[model samples]
Target: TVESRAIGPNMTACHHSYGRPDLLVYCCPPGFEKSVPFVDFELPEPPSPVKVRRPAHLLDESFIVKYNKALSIMKSLPYDDPRSFARQAELHCQFCTGAYEQLNYSDTPVNIHRTWLFFPWHRMMIYFHERILGSLIGDDSFALPFWAWDIPESMPMPDYYVDENSAFFHTERDFSHFPPRVADLDYTTDQNHPHRSNDEQIDVNLKFMYTQMVSGARKTELFMGCTYRANDGYCDTTGTVEHAPHNTLHTWLGSSLNPGREDMGKFYSAAKDPIFYAHHSNIDRLWEAWRKINNRRLDITDPDWLDSFFFFYDENLKLVKIKVRDVLDITKLGYSFEEVDHPWLNHRP
Candidate 1:
């Protein structure tokens, strides 16, 4: 099926398969000579996420009068024009305090892939924080849902903050303590992961999920790599392995990036923090469940990582500057996310 419209809703696609984008090629372990397996295809079946809890209140003035009547048909360009909305909130204040002073100054690690401006700067910081939460309830159709971190049951306690009773939360104090072994390198390596009293000790890489193949034309390996070699720690990246991708999770940061975690590239105040739009609506639902896993074969052609770029922090908090060509066009900057009737649990990593 694979229908259309995303983030705000109406996205039909019971399933479909995909292929070719340089047919999938990766090599870093001991400098390979050859390895191209995509094997033909078959890899969709890992979507079971929907756990957003923390609304309490705000948005009810009839949701800001039905979103100022959809912002009077949505349009706010000339605030003085630097490409206005007030010079894109003045380069979103050097992209959220210059990405928290270049990712808290460790040793240069920011790589949302060498840059076309990290996907239209987080799709114009999730379309100006979903149009300032749809201009505070006036309603431009309101859509915000990511937090599925690929599911370790939807992780929740990495030191949890944003008080005043869940004040529009959005974390990433640049959290740490991962590396039990994504091939281990040392962000202090071994913080002793018994997982602070076994929430299944990191829930086996969020339940497990990975299927990739194309075969003959070249190479492929993770016919379903489920992390932990053959399954022992079980699964746990839902709250930390720093959000997603390992066992060979290479977006290559989209393609060669690491100016030392440049504050993990903006989104700083996380759209006035309502848990940063439900943790980037579950990081845009794990980038649309990792492009409908395997069968959708993680598409993404890399013309310099398809011109990446990033900058965000909008809603009175300002900081805009986005591009990946305006998020490959998240439906011409509007809204469309649903999945919330509940019971999203077939489970996989």
Candidate 2:
């Protein structure tokens, strides 16, 4: 099993070893300086009626109002509270940008990205985020809406996120890539790349999605990412989807002028934007959708993969340690994605 430590009072500055030394990375909040105790995670009974996460484009005005209200309330909480929005965003920084080190290997950083840990870790992160959002609104059945960028009609940035007056809005994003602008699934940070019309871009995106989700992801390791075990220095291989649309979408939404694309462009500051949850909700849904593509499509059976763990502060502000095995099934977690037609499923490149 990959032994890990709960992020407590000992977090270090986030350093992107591969990036410019002068670049400043976001750090955990002052709240993390106070040692917090964590409890072993216990599986809760499935919700009475499974919470159905819908696409961002299809959300009604009422759903948008409720979501905006919940986020506003979460942001209003004291910074010391683990359930507060600032703390939650810092949690992503702690895990992804070398803020926490391995349990016994002080020199080795524990990074959840660019490895098999990517999916489950993010899944658990958003799971608790959704619960906290729902709890703030007094609605246990509320679910996070997904930005289904793979779909042609819903290709652009969702409308609700771009509303400047809404709580979901974040300032540090590329204004040129707003709604009605079809997202390039194979987006590149190179400014010189040629542009395509909406029809052409949609066709290209659908083909790209098919390649990433189908032809490119046939094996468990290929779909999930490279294995990362206890004391491993760093595993840099990422799954196809994680490499493209996932990372691409981040850079696409992030402000081009920022040092490292603040908010969505980089790991340390990604969750600072409220739309981060919606983006990840779609990534989580893709994991579920990928498994159903073939009878042989299954999760990694390695004991190390199943037994590795991470820590998170739940909706009630109680720190909990949860294993990867515990989050393999979304249904058991009391939420599911609403069924939708995947046009990209048939658009082979």
CA deviation > 4 Å runs, candidate 1: 1-76, 79-93, 96-131, 140-143, 147-149, 152-279, 283-349
Candidate 2's TM-score:
0.93
lDDT scores for all predictions? 0.32, 0.84
**Model 2 ranges off by over 4 Å:** 1-21, 29-35
- Compute the lDDT of residue 314 as modeled in candidate 1: 46
Task: Judging by lDDT against the true structure, name the best candidate.
Answer: 2
User: In angstroms, how far off is 239's CA in candidate 1?
Assistant: 10
Q: Go through the candidates in order and give the C-alpha RMSD of each one to the true structure.
A: 22.3, 2.8
Summarize candidate 1's per-residue lDDT along 181-249 as a digit string, tens digits: 121111122357333433443344333332111221011112211121111222322222222332112
How many pairs of residues collide in model 1? 80
